[model samples]
Target: MTKNHNSQHKDLMLQNSQKLDRLLTRLCKRSGCDEEEEHEGGNESVLFIAAKNGVLEILEKILKDKPGAIHETNSLDQNVLHVTVENRQPRVFEHLEKYLKEKELWESHVARADKDDNTILHLAAKLSRYKPRHIAGSALQMQWEVKWFLFMKKKMPHMQFLQNKSRKTPQDIFVRDHEDLLEQGIGWLKSTSESCSVVAALIAGVAFATATTFPGGTQEETGKPYLERHPAFNLFAFTPLWALFCSITSLITFLSILTSRQQPQDFRKDLPSKLLVGLSYLFMSIASVLASFSSAFFFLLRDHLQQVVFSLYAVAILPIAYFGVAQSPLYMDLMRATFRNIPQSSNRESEKLIL
Candidate 1:
């Protein structure tokens, strides 16, 4: 019976998309259960397998077939809710909440404790045993980590003060489990900041030199720029000024990342948020430098450089695009998830979105 159940679960996970009714019948027959009986046993049940593997379709079908299975526990005595949180399955997490509420099992199962006297909140705190690639990278990975811990904390307020069998609170477990990721995060942030600082310093130097060299030379008498009245010269003057300011701002922010205290809380909102702002400023500075260079180039070569304009613009965009494509996902994810007022759940399903 166990062998048959494992085989069926493996097939379902492999995406053998039979109708729920037909699949249930086959599972019943293969396991030697009569029609209309819920498949039973820990880890062997369809519900537990679906929750553990993040197969939301199979989970929903199992729930509809045997709503009681929503409360089923594995060898560790954790229900589907606990498994979903521990697995960090976003889609299953969202759908399960709705299912639990419709069936009125939120309180019984959500706060339900496992064998170690650890609730779903406790499971959420431990560094995941399974890492999903959908999370992008370590920076965003840590952000989502904090986000889930906070979500679970809010969902179960009493969980904040609750201690498990080991006598450690959820916060303690969270801080401890995340130690390695936090160090990795710090390394990522510092390296990112260091690289940006170099780029910013480079821009500052180029902008300074461009201003001193004065695109079309200076007037012999007044020491004024020669093309002071031309619109392109106005662009040349304004863009470098903007670039210099932005790069300086970026440099300061990245410098702060270098000096920030690498605490667990720092990863939550302090260091990462500042890194996001720094990256934004650096991006703007790079854009400003491109504009300044193009405008100055036009001023210096108006008579000779008309044909090469398009090619030159394309060349300038390559580096800018490279930096953007490489870093935009982390920036977008951090911006969207951090610094927001997350709504708390009280026996109600909160609509969860992927970061």
Candidate 2:
């Protein structure tokens, strides 16, 4: 049912896009103006608005009908590339790249600056007014911002050192524009680390206590666990040990994130990777702890209350399953932010946009 609804929604969007394209085409013809020409009231041109909002279909249709529209600029003297970069429209920028490459106008088009002498790189350095809906936290957002800046820097290395009217280079502009985001990212990382570290410490302590205290006590003569010969004994013996190791590792990983330098560059990979590791190990420790408890319960009830063991297992699994389900989105986002390739031409063939 959901799939059908989504398909219907997509079809509606497509139909609307086609209607918009026709309306724009007719409006251009009637006004005897190019698609790049601004309205009488200084409103943005259809092409620039499409690029800014990431309306790829509309932008493509206009560009296809009027190939020269790609060169048109807004009132600020910012071209399509500048507008796309400033608004963080990767798909539009990628489509424009294809057009530029086909026309053999890469150098001439990409090097153009706006009225403020801000190149595409400079615009990319500036943070967009709105955060992307798909990205979650400030730290991941900063990572994406860094990735975009680096991607553009790779595309036009010669322009990296170019200064705007304010005599600030792209790197300088990035630093100046992103100071608040950087601080937010640091606070986010530290807060997350502190919270997770406390949980990890608690899990480590529980696992340690469980491991030290044998189930059913020790036999008087041999000093061995009374339940050592039971099938469930192995689970009770090993799971707490595993849980202990995993919790300790998780705690250390979170501690590392807390003590990190928290630089802008660190958010690109280091901090996120550490957080991912810490999270994964913490989950493992939780699962192991649950398993150890279940196994110990089973060891005690194996003979007299065998049927009750299944109920106990079910009860033990609910929390772990709930935790996994609840945190899956964050885990997935962290994994993508940590390991996903930064989009650039060098790796363009293999790079898939996470945005």
Candidate 3:
């Protein structure tokens, strides 16, 4: 009896496989299925053919029978959805969305990118030639991703940032194409983009310099440099100290601003102002680091090795600054994501109509 049961199970599995294949074949041959063969000259494939005919009903049946069929890659190693997008057929999305919605494919496939490092969202955005349909469709797809992300966030509150193979967060890529949407929906919620106005380090320096005095040329018992009580210390002591403090404080704050995410409101209002803000901070940081080193060299350089060390360190400053400048564009995009809004489907549709 056990042997009979095992044989029956095997036979049933084989039957199911055959049934699935036949369903796929029938779906492929439906009306409006002029899609090219698997290795044919045109862009369409069998999976695309099934999708293009508005035969989503049959496609759904096949998918239900053989769930893994969607994972099959073509000669280009692209998943079915990727092929669907490449074909630029709106009807393909109709069937694909149905399959995805029924299967809850959003969370499962959210991070998947095709051969060209393009995610489904990326493909949708690239379907620009299809205009209003593609724009509206892509927005829906993005909304699905955002919903899935929010669901995951609720379930896993500790999830700080989601990273992909490209070392980018979903927000990173999303903001690149939909900056305003991100800012409106999510960017304002984070505090990393707020501006800092106080020059903190400079204030501290001024206070320190005001407290010291060289009095009466009397060397202390410790044989160290002593202050001979002088009125000059009382009057000008606070001035040098304050200047030094302000310089240092300004420098640190400037560096912080440069490295911080650029605010979208600022960038959108005036590109030059945003740029000047960055340049001002970068310049201040460099000058502050240099002034600190120079002060240490003149007043605190205790040994010959210190001079050599400062010189060697100075050599690295420009190269480091250059690399930081090179990465400015990427960080600018990230900052914009925090404050910018993505255009809505209706607006994009209207724009397409205008075009």
Candidate 4:
């Protein structure tokens, strides 16, 4: 059986090599033509052939001979690597590994999508027969995952399980036969607890401070009050002191969260990024809450246009806030759970995205 498998692989390799050589000759012949020189189509044909054949040796030589060829994109606005993954050609991935190793391509190799905006992994996960050529085992899989994840994590981490053009996720395609793996992923996310205590505390502080508010010459104004009066969005009513209290509370919560994560030996390393991310989220959330509250108040006061605008703005803020808070795995899990219930919408979005 081993001999037969080896012999088959050898035959396939020879056939592929012969096909690639013929393709190279044809492309070389066309490279000098006026029609080929007129557009990117011919250049793409050459790259597609090289990438599809996993002909890294020839590709490297071409790159060395004409570095400008590396910058070309195909008809669908994809690089050679993108075409390789799109075709589910493992040889292309093998060639890519060698190319990246020699040239540190990650710095220069920007991911371009097809008409559907699908990333390489997005294409791979959808391809049932796709298996990385040179790379093998969990090591290569994990490496690719990390690289792919890092590339798209910020924009759409939840997109892993989300369906794409082919109505599948990389997770779905990769783990189609493994129910346990799917369950494990969902279970891990669901287990992470959501953090709302700080937010609740901040809101409570706002309410308390609002209750303590008094205008000038009032009884509380004579005492040392928590906050002073500021011009409200509505000049008709006295401005609440809640914003000051909420801001202070949120700032304290942010600091506390930062402090808890700090290590004595490596305090500088961890604390700054956490502080920045946390504070940015807190400020944005507080501002949004204030905007929504003001909008609601104005709506009650019959300011229809302002109310509509503010309400729309508030609604738009939810996804952004979700992203800001998604550093908390629990919030992300909640989003996942919520999204799971609306699979039809998710699939629709995926289809639209693929389109």
Let me know the TM-score candidate 4 reaches against the reference structure.
0.29
Over the stretch 61-93, how does candidate 4's per-residue lDDT look in tens digits? 677788777667776667777766554444445
In model 4, pairs of residues that clash are none
Q: In candidate 2, what are the lDDT values of residues 126-232, reduced to their tens digit?
A: 98773433677888888888888887888889899999999999999999999999999899889989999999999999999999998889999989998788888
Per-residue error for 239 in candidate 3, Å, reads 14
Best by TM-score: 2
**Clash number for candidate 3:** 19
TM-score per prediction, in order, is 0.79, 0.85, 0.26, 0.29
lDDT of 3: 0.45
Q: Write the per-residue lDDT of candidate 3 for residues 1-355, one digit (tens) a residue.
A: 9999999999999997786566555545542234444344344444544543334444566578788777666544557765555334344455566767788884455456665565554444332322222321222333433433343334334322544467555446545655555354233222222332333343344435433432233365864334323333333334445445554554454455445454433333233233335434544444444443444333334346765766765674675478568756644543443243331122232222223
Ranking by TM-score: 2, 1, 4, 3
Q: Select the stronger candidate by lDDT from 2 and 3.
A: 2
Model 3: worst 10 consecutive residues (lDDT sum): 130-139
Worst 10 residues of 2 by lDDT: 346-355
lDDT value, residue 307 of candidate 1: 92
With candidate 3 superimposed using the best TM-score fit, by how many Å does residue 202's alpha carbon deviate from the native?
Answer: 8.6
- Evaluate residue 46 in candidate 1 and report its C-alpha lDDT on the 0 to 100 scale: 68
What alpha-carbon RMSD in Å does predicted model 2 have with respect to the real structure? Answer: 7.7
